[model samples]
Target: MLKDEVLKILLSSGSHVSGQDISNKLGVSRTAVWKAVTALKNDGYDIESVNNKGYLLTKNKSILNEAEIETCMHLYDCKVFPKILYFNSIDSTNTYAKKAADLIPSDFLVVADTQTLGRGRLGRSWSSPSSTGIYMSLCIRPNISLEKASMITLITAMAICDAIEELYNISPLIKWPNDIVINSKKICGILTEMSCDMDGIKYIISGVGINVYDTEFPDDIKDTASSLLLETGTKTDRAKIISSAIYHFYEDLDTFMQTEDMSILKSKYESRLANIGREVMILDPKGEYPATALGIDETGALIVNANGKIKRIISGEVSVRGIYGYT
Candidate 1:
């Protein structure tokens, strides 16, 4: 924990921070600060210690820790997620978060290094390799009705797209409901699950899986999957992405909850909609049909021109590759 605190100080500082300053801030001795710095260096942070200048984080190479995430949150002045639960390995962050939603405080985050049983939308498997991607779930209890819950998914897509563009200057598009893509390849997938009663939602667990540094995907998903490094040719700080996403989500959450509709975010979300004006195949249970995507409605449903009729689809299997060559 001392190392995390020291790391927060080093990460937030633009220049070197004096050891005495750190000692005074954290109420620890210089020896303890030195030990914390040593531990951080051992954990793969590039920390430089100058005799007169004190310490600085010279470089960050895909480094992710609680302190770094907290530092990013502090930089954004966001306090939506009051507590963070981190794990080295787990079955699934969403699963863990759902089980602990009622037990822990509201609006807590669950992050994992790797997931043995990661899930995607429609019950598909999400690839979560160790130390190569971000597998996280944010558990929140919103008092919105079931009809308005889909807005959370759309808001999440916008949050991630904003975060990626702000951090890496790469434009990411939303593949309709719950996928974030860069250059037509999926860089992130979101799965939002909720527990509810007849009254309203008790908790919503939003699981996000991001490809950060993986050079290769599984043979099955290689064609449709991509990583941040592969897309931008640079390694990214996963914690910053996480913090930025949460920051943006909380930024728009108030208006969304107030109006309980997409009036505030409709245009912004449609600007990044990958399916606009594109021909897509809607996989209906009775039969498949071709349609042209017009955009999304105020309720976050995809509006499409099904031949001569206008249809607003809430959620189903829809393929956007008729325009983008992606699944």
Candidate 2:
């Protein structure tokens, strides 16, 4: 707790803070302050000490830490700041969020620096290197029906796009249901999973992964996958992005829950859809269909012109060459 208080002081100060000031503020001794500083340093904060300047947080490479994230949440004025469970490395944020769903509050979040077995839609692997991306899952227990759960994925995508645009002034596009793209390259992904019964929905976990500072990718995905750093030529503030996204997501979710209608977000979501007006290959269980995307309907379903007939694609694996070159 003392370390968190010291961290708050250092983060707010934005300059060197003397040990005596920190100790006096917390009513603790200078030795205790030193111990807290040492613990913070051991926890991966790049704190600098000088003979006269005292301690300065030179760098915060660990952006996903609980204290930093909570500070960011407070800064953004989130209505209800969720309890965050942070991990240095994990298999999957979604997996953990699901397991902890019943125990934690509906607004709880599970975040990780890296996920060794990160996942995407359709059981695909997501690359999650340490300290380079945001891998987080938000658990919400909305009193909505199972049929409306898919719309949450679209809501999350819109929130991510809005966050990136507001933070960096770069407009990112949503690829159909859950992917975010920039310049036809994948920058973010969202995977929504749920647990439910006849008595309405129980809990839904929205997993979001954003490639922030990473500049390298596997040979197979190098051309299609990209990072905010690579696209914008600068490192972004991860904590700010996270806080902004959660803030916007809750704001949009409140509107959605009241009406249970994707139409509330249809216009904004349609404006940022990348697949609209593009030729795409839809992989459905029955068969594959090549179609030109028109746009999303009020229910968040993909409306496309399949051959000469107009069909609404409720759910499928949509492969657009303009998105990731999946043929």
Model 2: lDDT equals: 0.86
Residue-by-residue lDDT tens digits, candidate 1, 84-188: 888889999999998899798668889999999999877888889999999999888888887788789888889889988998998899888888888889999
Candidate topping lDDT: 1
Per-model TM against the reference = 0.94, 0.91
Model 1: residue 267 alpha-carbon error in angstroms: 1.0
Residues 1-327 of candidate 2 have per-residue lDDT tens digits of 898889888887788999999999999999999999999998888899888789999987746677777787887767657788888899999999999997876579888999999999889999999989999999988898888888999999998998999888999998888889888788999989999999878999999999999989989889788999999997777877888999989888988877897878888889998888888878776777788889988788988888879988775444433323522
Q: Kindly report which residue pairs in candidate 1 clash with one another.
A: none
